[model samples]
Target: MSTAVHDHPHGHDDHAHHPSGLARYLTTTNHKDIGTMYLWFSFAMFLTGGVMALVIRAELFQPGLQVVNPDFFNQMTTLHGLIMVFGAIMPAFVGFANWQIPMMIGAPDMAFPRLNNWSFWLLPPAALLLVTSLFVPGGAAAAGWTLYPPLTVQMGMGMDLAIFAVHILGMSSILGSINIITTLLNMRAPGMTLMKMPLFCWTWLITAYLLLAAMPVLAGAVTMILTDRHFGTHFFNPAGGGDPVLFQHIFWFFGHPEVYIIAIPAFGVISQVIPAFSRKPLFGYTSMVYATASIAILSFIVWAHHMYTTGMPVQAQLFFMYATSLIAVPTGVKVFNWVATMWKGSLSFETPMLFAIGFLFLFTIGGFTGLVLAIVPIDIQLHDTYYVVAHFHYVMVAGALFAAFAGVYFWIPKWTGRMYDETLGKWHFWLSFIFFNMAFFVQHFLGLAGMPRRIPDYALQFADFNMVSSIGAFGFGLAQLLFLYVVVKCIRSGEQAPAKAWEGADTLEWTHLPSPAPYHSFETPPMVK
Candidate 1:
């Protein structure tokens, strides 16, 4: 596979022959170049969305609206959801795919590199459409990120912009899925079979298929809303022979799978980061694979659990309750396998491992809350309340965002050829962990007290808890700046990283390639066995 290691550290000067500056990014089809752009773009969106969240939190801090008005608050919530889900979290994981997939599988680049370039280029314009909607006469789509029925129909051109953004984003996602599927199936090196692929690759492969199946459904849902808003169709408007429940059905059909589309990649990241720090092979690898596929398959049937309060028949409620409950089994399997991998092994609390263990702890909490909400009666009590909000943040922040943190810390050495500040890295993790809990943990109380979500103001009874949550929210948001510093410091002036930075990193990227991989990676595909 490799005769000797080359010292290709830090600056990728091997390709002075390659284009530089803005030209390198705009027109280049190289996987790593495109990957870097995707990451930077995602971080920019994360900050953009984080600001919206802070605005929402600030308003909720007091009984009367102190920061933004009711309408503005809705805009913040709506834009925050759209930006985080579509613009921040999803793109971060796709950045990982663009960077890691080719290297892990010993392919020179993605099978469809030009398509990769085009897919990433689609995001910024979509983001522009979303953010710019705020300045429009109607002040963005206030019907919430779900773009739910009658409100969307009544909204102004802002809703149309949001709809068009969704369309562009969906097209980007569809193209990405096709590229990933083809690359995985048709481009593995001589001996790297499907079963032998890294768990991250396996997870992404499944996620790609989920994207392929679900994106069009979301596109259709939003398109119908667009027609209702503009062309006077009644797909979801009751006055014109339509049912609003139809929107929920179609949205959740795509939406529930979207949860796992974010999660399963996280599952893959934890799978890798945990075992490497534990100095053990991942426990029950085969079963982990099957479990992941099971989760993806189960995601389809459980969409109705989210709709139970909308007056589905009791039988349908029971069916969804049971179906949603069944997902916990495979999820529990993945968690069990991760914990088992760390049992009695040489564990180290590197920043990556700290983030992984945090993911294990909090994501489990989210999963438990998810189970609690799966019960029909319990969900009826908590619907549209802060409890649902708390549960979702735990899942998305811990499940996907924490795992993304771990992956960045784990692989930044490879990507940048320099070591991150260990001290600052730990600080980043601890600050994030403590403040995140402080911000969100109290929201559970607010929800149980019957405070509804998506509101600008709350009753005085929810006051003290909301204040604490806001303070914590501010702290948590500030902690991310430390993360940014750690990464930038590593890249600009940190110590040089060796080829194998982690003692137990066993993937082809670590074992067969040098640090800060060469521009033309795998000029000759490394044989697996």
Candidate 2:
């Protein structure tokens, strides 16, 4: 993708309305449009996935499967994980990359424009297949997102649908990675060296590499499972000399890094937003870069941490335990940098800043819990419990999802040239923060009290906390409506934003672009210095 912004009537002149048509979306490969598509699509998937979460929470509300059948609840859980991971969070970050990277780096478009279009178009059908699975005779795969065998083998058409969807989603992600890598490497404007790229770009570059390496592994793992389910292979079937544990080895080999692939850019977003709101250059820029790369490298070796309870040998257990624990060091460095950047700076808590702070506090709580879970003995007690679920929700939702919202609020002026209602944004932030923690925090106690995960019903002893969690879930769900309203209101009408929306912002993006960036950007590279 070229990085130059060109003069155009629609993107440049805010008054000019562009045509809305299939062709406009289909034929054009503009990074902004594609980025918009990804954001909107991911938002749609979020609602879809969120509904599934509601179903899960509702079913577990009173522990008697009130709203849905046990089978459907299982399906909801499985689909919810799949959609949130692939359809929501992954695409949202890619959307951010598409919208921001070129602008930040002074590029015109992605490196491979047509391929970008192809990558996005692939998602809808794949998403449709996933949604469509619930209606199939055997219902959506109840095997959970992990798709471990025996149970997975029993799932009928839904499993096949899921496998096929995985193929398409994987292809889309890989192609998207290729486009990103190409753009960052080959399309950066003159004087924009690799080290000079923004933290978001750096994190994404590493994420894309992780995606490239791990997505193929996922593809292969799923394909093998598909063959095992249909073609009489025993890749994970003990009856035929294949081992289920082997399946885990391969899956986690991909799955663990896949966690960071979704998260590292979130770290980048938090890094970007903190400095802007804090009015300080990011502290430890080089340390942040090295920390992210270190995380990516360590992610490969720590896959077995998820499987410590599967009776791995003692040495294997110790290795994964220690390897996984080491990640906390780099992650801690990142947290310290963010806090240090804010120390004694001219910090005003804007909505974006509020969310960034929320991410730090809540994500740190999750990280501490993760360290506990990383210990082999504790993992034995907590594996596959609501405790584990709570941990990741903090990391993914409070961490990744919160950071995603911050990125949106921080850049909305650039995207829409309108300031969102600040009062409403703050309302959305506080309400979301309170309700989100309300929903997931107590789940830790529930997990500690011997409640297993993925079950629709629980014993009477677990009722009180579960009720609290359910109420919190509904509240959190309602709060997102406010988010939708805030975003839509900004898009429709708000105070006009200036060329540089935030005072402390320093990316090439703010320097080169107007409020609401041009459809074609940077016809000529601006001098960086």
Candidate 3:
């Protein structure tokens, strides 16, 4: 059940690379090229979302609104969450899956290569719809990222545009899921059995299925909103015999799993990166697999935790509360497995490892906060406060975003055929780690102190912490420019990388493939022993 792929290199002509330029990108089916596109697109959107975040932070810098009004501030909040979640983080992982999966599994390319191309292409128009909606008449959906109703139902053309964008994104996710699932199931090398595959693949396998199952529910939720808004229906409209609370049920059903959709992949990256730097096989690999599956199974039952404030019956609230707490068990199993992997191994503090460690520390805080929020009495006090905001950023920004930076540092050498400046990489890590904490950590105090989220202005006492957060937010945003420079320098010309850049890296990409993986990763099935 434990195995690794052993791919054989082919003749030089087999490296017949794809054509260069805009034309090639427009029509190419090469997964590496496509993966590059996804990463770049995600980065672009990351900046877009980050800017929106700064606008939010700046407005809140003082008790009184300084820059924007409440309505526009809500727009920034709405678009920021949507862009970061769908446009930045999700695609970034898909980029990794596109680049890593076939290579790791010892297959030539994705099973449905053309479908892969279409799936990636679908993102731009979707992102455009979201971003450009700002210039529209009603000025985007001010109804927060959740798109809760009555508010959403009354919003303008921008809302419809957002709905269409969600539909397209859902379609894109479905198509990408199908490609990933089909490739993993049918195209894996002869000996790469399910249990033998890398933890990253397993996480993605679960994540793809999560997407397949969860995305349609979101599609249905949004579709109902669209119909209710434009058509004669009142699914969430009280006047039309609709129940708005029902929308929360549907949305959270999709939304809760969406949290894992992002985190699971981040967990996958941490799994790979931690073991590599620690020079150890992942501890509890088998348990990690089972724990992942368990978490996925538990995700469905816990959706209603978000609805605790809606005045559902105590029995229903208790069901969701306990169910929510149960997910932490498997999640903790993952955390324990990671820590055990690094317990006494030959650890190195490379940029990737630094980011991985940061992820572990901050993500745990995020989880603890999540558990705190899971309690009915506590959540009733803290729900929708800056405390909730602090919790998720710790999860999404520290947890998922840090993991992403770790992955990029870990693999940039292989992807680009060059090693990045180690000093710059380290600088990037330290700066990001420091500035990130500055920005969001105080928000916890703000939340505990009762500052609400999505508001442009706040009460007098919250001013100092808001200023600190704004400064930290700006610093955090600036640190990413260094990350961008580091990656660009690597691609343009850093140091030439060897076949195995990291001596401890043991996967097929490191052990078998050259520094830059060949255009056709597996011309024939690799004999991985």
Please estimate how well model 1 matches the true structure, expressed as its whole-model Cα lDDT: 0.93
TM-score of each: 0.97, 0.97, 0.98
Q: Using lDDT as the measure, which candidate wins?
A: 1
- Model 3 backbone overlap count: 1
Ranking by lDDT: 1, 3, 2
RMSD value for candidate 3: 2.3
* Residue 196 CA displacement from its true place in model 2, Å: 1.1
Which residue pairs clash in candidate 1? none
Give the alpha carbon lDDT tens digit for every residue of 374-417 in model 1: 99999999999999999999999978999999999999999998
Ranked candidates, highest TM-score first: 3, 1, 2
> Each candidate's root-mean-square deviation in Å?
2.8, 2.3, 2.3
- Scored against the true structure, residue 155 in model 3 reaches a CA lDDT of 96
**Candidate 2 lDDT by residue in tens digits, 1-529:** 3334454423333343445688789766888999999999999999899989998988888967688888888999999999999999999999999999989887778999999999999999999999999899999988888888778876799999999999999999999999999999987888788889999999999999999999999999999999998898998888899899888999999999999999999999999999999999999999999999999999999999999878889999999999999999999999999999999999999999999999999999989999999999999999999999999999999999999999999999999999999999999999999999889999999999989999999999999999999889999999998999999999998899998999989998787789889887765665565
Q: Cα lDDT for residue 366, model 3?
A: 97
lDDT of each: 0.93, 0.92, 0.92
